[model samples]
Target: MSATTTTAETAEPAPVHAESLARLLVAGERPPRPNALRTSLTFGWRAMLKIKHVPEQLFDVTAFPIMMVLMYTYLFGGALAGSPTQYLQYLLPGILVMSVVMITMYTGVSVNTDIEKGVFDRFRSLPIWRPSTMVGYLLGDALRYTIASIVMLAVGLLMGFRPDGGFMGVAAGVLLLLVFSFAFSWVWTMFGLLLRTEKSVMGVSMMVLFPLTFLSDIFVRPETMPGWLQAFVNNNPVTHVAAAVRGLMQGSWPSMEIAWSLGWAALLIAVFGPVTMRLYNRK
Candidate 1:
């Protein structure tokens, strides 16, 4: 009996206290939750990291803007304004608006891609602010929009497109564009959460963007169009935004256009932002 007890004792492992085991596993108290801005910025950094890893993502911002400036400046210069240099002045700002606006659709594509990869599901399980993921996508794309705008401006300057608005006016114009773009992105975020596939997000974005962009006064004056088309173009929000940006760059304030653009941008955000969050929560 003594030998059997000794053998059993030798076979048993040492007992571990709950306190000691917990101390070994978790060393410190939990840290406070991060603020919304910090969380949003962190997610934004993640988006930027993606661009850093995939440098090819910059092609639309760089090469595409350069191509648009060259193609349109030369193509419409002779026929529309009698000279490339003369046409560039009228075309550059409008092109800047159109290019940046068109690229904003990619924000939806990125969101849909993340959703497809199940990245957003992991994000949702975290303790961070709910809308940070969506906001981060826009913040990242905002940087891209700024880059595309600068590229367009540089190409325009090389081709004799001068901004009479000088530095401040040009800066204000770009700022307005960024603000509008940020608000516009919420619409796509809603679509991103709603769509099942990246391709579907892209298809819908194209259909909406192409019509809004082409039907506006980006390429030509509204009066030059048929009366019915002119009415639509005149009332189009893109027209107000393009006009506001064009006016700001040319040294004209166009306060009414700016107001209209801001109003439209605010409307877009107010309507789409919550819808996106709702879809995100359900998703």
Candidate 2:
């Protein structure tokens, strides 16, 4: 009995190899490289559903434009345009630009919230293209922008504001605004990925955006501003976008301003797009 016990004690268990461990991990897991278009559509639908469930998420888009048109047209209209109706013609386009750009910060906030909640991790674990997540968010946010534009324009129309550019011009203006808004959103996207918290992302976004919107010719003509401020406003990309919209809607055909706005939009996308993606992958 002692000899048998000694022989048993000398016996060893089988060693596990790296390949076996890998196979174990891979077992019952189908690597999920889904089609990119399908993945984007799937995630986009999810974003839309989230908005539907949390209807209050759109309060800013729905209510803020109306308030801005009313308040600005009433309070500043008489002073700026000599009449509220006249001011509406000038202010509507700029307000539309400002409103859409303002809402882009929400994109950063939303992305940051998803990261903090581990949704991005879940997305990575799946076999879908990583960019599909951002594409979907942006596609869904496009609908939000459309809603804001419609509300703003409708309010302006009711308040006796008319766009001399007619329907085609209005369409062109919308297209340009959307293009700028999408490109500008990349700035917030990078911030959301790099920042530690959603609050920080929002704070930083506001700090950057407030200056762009307020300092530009959004409310008044740049000529009325101080010389230094006029120079800054003239160079500000927001000012260019607003001028483009104004020219389109007011039948002034601001071709130069439109070209400048497009250039700025392209620059923003070229610079921030890759940086945001790099940070996203690192995270």
Candidate 3:
């Protein structure tokens, strides 16, 4: 027994060679590279997974919208519209747009966060569609925009906010908002790639967003503003977006405004999409 055990213990293992080791590690034919849609969707799923692991990220889409609806509805309600409930009719749609639009900055923040963590370096080295990564960020953020809109709509309904356009109209409005948001996100994503830090991204996004959102028809009518302010407010893309949404909700079907909104959304994508990709490629 001692002789047999010693022989087993001293037995030499098979010699390892590079070619044989590679064969053992090969995953068969290296499946064809994923297409852009597949890769983008995969990255989008990865974003959702991050949200799943850290559910606290959902607070902005939920709690923040609620607070905006409540605060704006009550604080300016009586003063602006003679009653809180009365104000909601005019305010809800605008607030909804404002809430969702404001949170878009988080896209840049997320991108910068990933870059800081070295996640993007690996992404850059992958043999996949170049724009898929940024597109994925926009697609994942679409869910957030939807959640924020739904939350705002629910709160508005509970507060006696009524829309004449009914469910179909509201749905169409939300669809349009999502479309706009999808295009608008490219702007921030570009900033995310350009800026050195997430904080810089956030700061720049805020400087732009605050003026972009507040200087429009979100809180009041453009006609009521001073001449110079009205010029900016009337031409502001947010004004067109808010007008389109409000009209849709109220069953007005503001075709001109909708066209403007869609046009602006397209323009944003056209201008920023290429810039974002270039920055991404260089980064």
Q: Pick the candidate with the highest TM-score.
A: 1
Rank all candidate structures by their lDDT, best first, as comma-separated numbers: 3, 1, 2
The candidate, 1 or 3, that scores higher on lDDT is 3
lDDT of 3 by residue, 1-283 (tens): 9999999999999999999999988957778999999999998998888889999999999999999999999999999999999989999999888988989999999999999899999999999999999989888989999999999999899999999999999999999999998988888999998999999999999999998899999988887889999999999988899999999999999999999999999999999999999899888
lDDT of 1 by residue, 1-283 (tens): 9999999888977799999999987888789999899989988899899999999999999999999889988998999989999988888888898899999988988998998999988999999999998998999899999999999898888878889999988999999999999999998888888998988999999999988888998888887889999888999888899999999999999999999999999999999999999999998
Best by lDDT: 3
- Judge candidate 2 at residue 26 and give its lDDT: 87
- Go through the candidates in order and give the clash count of each: 0, 1, 0
| Model 3: lDDT to the true structure | 0.93
Model with the higher TM-score, candidate 1 or 3: 1
Residue range with the least summed lDDT across 10 consecutive positions in model 2? 25-34
| Model 2 lDDT tens row, 57-106 | 89999899888889888999998779999888889999999999999998
